[model samples]
Each structure stands twice: as C-alpha cells, then as structure tokens.
Target: MTPDTLNFIIIDDSKLDCFIADKIIRNTGKAGDIKSFTNAATALEHIKETPPPADAKTTVLLDIQMPVMNGFEFIEAFEQLPAEIVGGYNVYMLSSSINENDLNRVKNYHSIKQFLNKPLTSSALAAILEEQAQ
Candidate 1:
C-alpha cells in the first residue's frame, strides 16, 4: 500500500521534529492516521495497548535519542511483544547523529526497516512507502 493509506507514528523527543514529520507525512496524502509522542515510553506503552492487525499497513518513525528510553531501548522492549502484535508494522529508527555505532546497532534488529536521518523528507518517505509496497 502507498503511504497515503499507511498509518504513521512519530516517536521523537523534539516537538519540532514531530511537527515537521507530521507535516511531511500529511503532504504525502497517503497517510491514514498519524500519531505523535514526545516520550518514547509513552509510545511503547501505546504500542503495547494497540497492536496493529495482521493486514494493517503501518509505519513508525522512532527517534534514537530520548530522556528515559532511547530508540534502542524501545526496540528492546518492543521485541518482547508477540509476533502478531509487532510483526505487521515497519519500524524505522530516526536520528540526526551519524554515529557509526548507532548505524551498526540497527543491523542487529530485524524489526527496524532502516535508519533515517533527521528532518524527514517527502522523497524519503515516498521511497520507503514504495519499497514497502513491493
């Protein structure tokens, strides 16, 4: 499915980042329902509470740097969820830092689709959505 019909969740500590990402996702006209959470912990909790359906097309853009739970920590927790609960969603780690360690760490997780640099762009989102369609 295209991004226009995909649900998007923006989990970032920065309010501005969330706002910008939200706008970018909206501009795609393929986004179904967009949700944002400044707190990673809250976002994780919400994920636990509301798992996507097996056929649901959803994507989560999670920030790697946060106060309590970073993206890695969130993934660690998210991994504990049932396959049916987390399997249907694509999770992308979003970060401004280009640290090699962070990039390598993402390789360890099968759930993470890819690492996206800060300031989500329409073209990037479009490409990701197209890839998912394949």
Candidate 2:
C-alpha cells in the first residue's frame, strides 16, 4: 500500500506532545489518518478493535510515560493482541525520558519499530512511512 493509505496512532500522556507529533507527521506529507491517544489502555483496546487492512500501512508514535498505563504496558498488551490485527501497524516509542533502563525495556518488545526522542520530527515520520512502503 502507498503512504496515503496509512493510518497512524500516537499515544502520549501530554496532549501537547501528541499535537506536535501529529503536525510533524502531516508536515512530512506521508500520513493520512493519524489518531492520537493520551493513555495506553484505551489505545491498546482501539488497536485490538480496529483491524487494519492487510495491505494497509500504519505507524504509532508512543510515549514512555502515562497515567493508568505506560508505553511498556501498552507493548505488553499489544503483544497479546492477535497478530492479524496488531501486526498491521508499526510502533515507535516517542519519549523524552533518557533512562537507559526504559530504552532497554522497550527494546525487549520486538514489535517496537524505533525509539524517538521528544518533539517528533518530519524526517523520523518520513523514514517510518518509507519503511512501511517496503
């Protein structure tokens, strides 16, 4: 599928961060429908509920910390989701935390596409979309 067909999800406790990510992804002109969530619990449920098209491409910019559920918790729940549903999208951790432990923990989840620092950039979003094209 092409970039226009892609659907993205951004999970960050801070609404401002989510807005920034959304803007950057759009500025890259590679994203179509990008959804942002403040909590992982709801986002996890959304991912499980909505099964994306097989050929469709999607990306998720996840935050490391949040109320109720953190990014790691999301990954755990995300992994439990059926492959047919969760495998459709690529997930990346967008965090401001510089803790090695957090980074190492996220790495444990193979599904994580990449680790992005705060203030999502266009280049990162483009790279992710380009990767999904392949």
Candidate 3:
C-alpha cells in the first residue's frame, strides 16, 4: 500500500516537526488528507469526535516527549477507545532519544507499531507503506 492511499495524523509538541512531517508526506504525491496536532489531548479528542472513513487506513506519527500528555499517556488513552475505532489506525512512536529505558517502555505498548527516530524521512515513510502492504 502506498502512502497516497493512507491518511496520516501527526501528533507532536513541536509545530516545526509537524510541518516537516506534513511536507514529507505530501511530497509522496496523491497522499491522503493529513492532520497535525501539537497537543496529544487535542489529537485524541479529534480522533474520538471525528473518526476516519470506514475504508480509510490511518497512520499516527506520535512524538515520545510532550508537555501534558506524553506519547505513552496518549497511547493509554487511545487504548481505552473502542476496538473498532482503534483497529482502523496504526501508531508509530517517534523520538530522538536513544534511552534504552524509553525503548523498552515502548515495547510494552501493543498499540505501537514501531519506534522511529526523529526527523521523519521519505525512506521511513516508504518502509511503513511496505510493511502495511504485507
């Protein structure tokens, strides 16, 4: 599956990071609608209030560090949502930190598809697409 066929939701405290990720995803050509939030709580609210279309496959790019609700907290809340709602999306944790503890903690969350390094890249996006295609 190509990124063009998937919707993306980017949650990061850094507005600049969100912009960069949005730009990278858009460059893929025909990419689906992309929404970004600097606050994890707001993002979660949006997810609850506005569910994606039934046929849409949504991928969430979440940052590990944030002010109020961190990525782990966000995942915990997300997991509380209905299974049907949760099943429509895949979550990826993005962090520049190489802390072994952080990495290990990420492994505890079954909702997280993978932990990616900071600065979203086309190659990483492509890899996600390929993995989803399986």
Candidate 4:
C-alpha cells in the first residue's frame, strides 16, 4: 500500500529501536503517519478509543517482548475489540526474538499477519506491502 494511504503504529519498549524503525519506515516514503509507543497499555487504550474505521488501511508493528503487557497480552485484548474496528487492522509481530517457542506461539493469534525479525528492513517492508497488495 502507498504510504499516504496507510497508518503505521510501532510498539516497542526500546526508545532507540522505535526511533530507528520509524526512520526506516519514513524512508520508505509510504507511511501516511507513524505513531510509536513505548508501552503497550497506552497504545491499547488509544486503539480501543480510536479504533480504525473499517475501510481505512492500518498496520501495527508490535514487539513480542515488553514490560507489564507483552505483545501476546496486547493481542489477547485486541482480539476482544469490536469487529468493525478490528477488521481494518493488519497486525504484525516485529521482534528481535529468535526463540523457537516464541515464534511457534504467535500462530495462536489469528489476527497476526506474520512474525517479522527486526530491525525492519526496506526489503522486508517491501515484501509486506507486496504480499498485502496481492
């Protein structure tokens, strides 16, 4: 999808990683707006309050590991959201984790489109867009 047509949300506990990922995403020149959150709870609240419209293009890049509420916990909460809001989102797990168990566990979330290794790369981003386009 074109950057101007998509909203990107990056949730990671590390400030530096969030910054770097934001930069990479901006470099693609396809992101309409990018929002970053260091905590999952706050992000979850925003999502709950302003759930994307059903026809809007939105993608969330979430880190698997975070203090308090991890990505899985966020997913659990997200799964309970109204279908109208949830239908507009494409959730991807973006993490530095290489654990087989962690990777295997993501399959439980039907909402997650894919589990991506970070830091996010241009090629990987392109692949995501391309795949989604198809």
Candidate 5:
C-alpha cells in the first residue's frame, strides 16, 4: 500500500491542536489528505454524506471531549456508518486528559486502534508507521 495515499481526519475542539497534528502528518510526508473538524456532528455528517473510497485507507485522530458531541458520541454515530467504509479504516483517539475512566470508556470501541496523548510527537508518528508495518 502507498502510505502517502492515505487520508486522515482530525476531530478536535482545539484548532491549534488540529494544526499541530496536521503539521506533524505533513512533515512525515505521509497521508494523501487531512481534514479537521471542530465538532463531531459536522464531521459525522460529512462522513455519512461523502464517505471515503474503500481504497483511500483513511484514519481519524479524534478528541474525547468537545462542546457538541464528544468522541464517544461521534464513534457511536459513526459506527452506524455503512459497513463498507466502517471496515476500511481506523480511528485513533487523541486527548490531553489521561483519565482512566475516559480511557476505559473509549476502549469499548473496537474500531479504535489506539490512543494518543496531545502534541503528536515524532516518536508517536514513527510508532504509527511501525504499527502499520506490523
């Protein structure tokens, strides 16, 4: 697979955080497209309206807390998405809070491949590459 051809979505209430993650992804020269949304509803709607192509290999870096729908709510809404796209991608949670309860709640989601702390680092990016390699 061409890793650079994959798309990514950042769902976070903080635009600054989104910008940082976007920059990191771009710096790595991976991912074909990157989209950011401040709210879960709009992001979910976009996913429902124009789903990514199966060949796109998309990943989402989602935040667990937001004004509208939280990450868990987003996941629940997204889980209802058509199975084709559901089966074709991954969602990784990104958060600054290290609350065990929150982490536990999110773990219930099978689609969530991993959790990432804020300020996406080079090592974290490399780890993703390693996971992809594995």
Candidate 6:
C-alpha cells in the first residue's frame, strides 16, 4: 500500500488520549480510516473479525498500561493471528510508564516496531509515517 493510504487503529484506555491521537493523526492528513478502542480485547476482536484489505497498511497504536488486556497481552494475542492477517499491520506500543522493565520488555516482541511515549505528537507521528514511507 502507498504511504498516503495508511490506516490506523488506536487502542488506549484513556478516552482523552485516544481523542488527542485521533485529532493529531487526522490533522496530518496522512491517515485513511482511524479507529480507536478503549479496550484492547475489543480492538483485537475487531481485527480478527474484520481484517483490512490486503493492500492496505494499518498501524496499531497500542497503550501499554490498560486494565483488562495490556499492551503486552495484546501483543501475545496478536501474534497468534495468521501470518497474512498480521502482515498487514504494524504495532507500536505507547505508554506513559517509565518502568525499565516495561521498556525492556518491548524488545522481546518481533511484531512491535517501537515503543512510544504517551500523548502521540505530530512530530512522532511524522517520524513514524516517514519510516513507513520507505
């Protein structure tokens, strides 16, 4: 898929954070469809039930500090999906927590592109987009 046609899925427990990210992503005019879920499990279900088009590239912004299903847990579940379905997605873990363990744990997941700090900014999004462009 072309970079300009990239879609997004944001999974964060905080509604405000999700709203902020949705607005920031929209302002860049780089996203196609942006869907946000306060629950990681529900987001996972959506991905499993309704996969994106084969040519579409979808980026997942997952928050690490959630109640029911945390980012790590989500990653575990996400990895179980079929390779073709998982191939269309790029997961980036987002968290406000500075716990050394949390930061270190992200490295273990091959599917996780990077770990980003909370409150997704335009610059960070731009960098991510630029990376995807290549």
Top-lDDT candidate index: 6
- Please, what is the whole-model Cα lDDT of each candidate in the order they appear? 0.88, 0.82, 0.90, 0.86, 0.83, 0.92
- Where model 6 places Cα greater than 4 Å from the true spot, the runs are 1-3
lDDT of 3: 0.90
Residue 14 miss distance in model 1 (angstroms): 0.2
Q: How high is the lDDT of residue 71 in model 2?
A: 86
Write model 1 residue lDDT over 1-134, tens digit each, in one string.
42328888899999999999999988987888899999999998888898675556579999998998899999999999988878867999999988999999999999998999988899999998888878
The reply for model 3, stretches above 4 Å from the true place, is: 1-4
Clashes of each: 4, 0, 0, 2, 0, 0
**Best-fitting candidate, measured by TM-score?**
6
RMSD of each: 1.5, 1.4, 1.6, 1.7, 1.5, 1.1
Give a tens-digit lDDT track for model 4, residues 53-127: 545558899999999999999999999999877777899999999999999999999999999998888888888
If scored against the real structure, what TM-score would every candidate get? Answer: 0.94, 0.92, 0.94, 0.92, 0.91, 0.96
Model with the higher TM-score, candidate 3 or 4: 3
Q: Write the per-residue lDDT of candidate 6 for residues 1-134, one digit (tens) a residue.
A: 36557799999999999999999999888779999999999999999998777776699999998999999999999999999888889999999989999999999999999999977899999999999888
Question: In angstroms, what RMSD does candidate 2 have relative to the true structure?
Answer: 1.4
Task: Output the worst ten-in-a-row residue range by lDDT, candidate 1.
Answer: 1-10
Misplaced by over 4 Å in model 4 are 1-4
Task: Report the backbone clash tally of model 6.
Answer: 0
Spell out the clash pairs found in candidate 1.
Answer: 3-30, 4-30, 4-31, 5-30
Q: List the residue pairs that clash in candidate 6.
A: none
- Residues 33-130, model 3: lDDT tens digits: 89999999999999998877787569899999999999999999999999988988899999988999999999999989999998899999889877
How displaced is residue 19 in candidate 4, in Å? 0.9
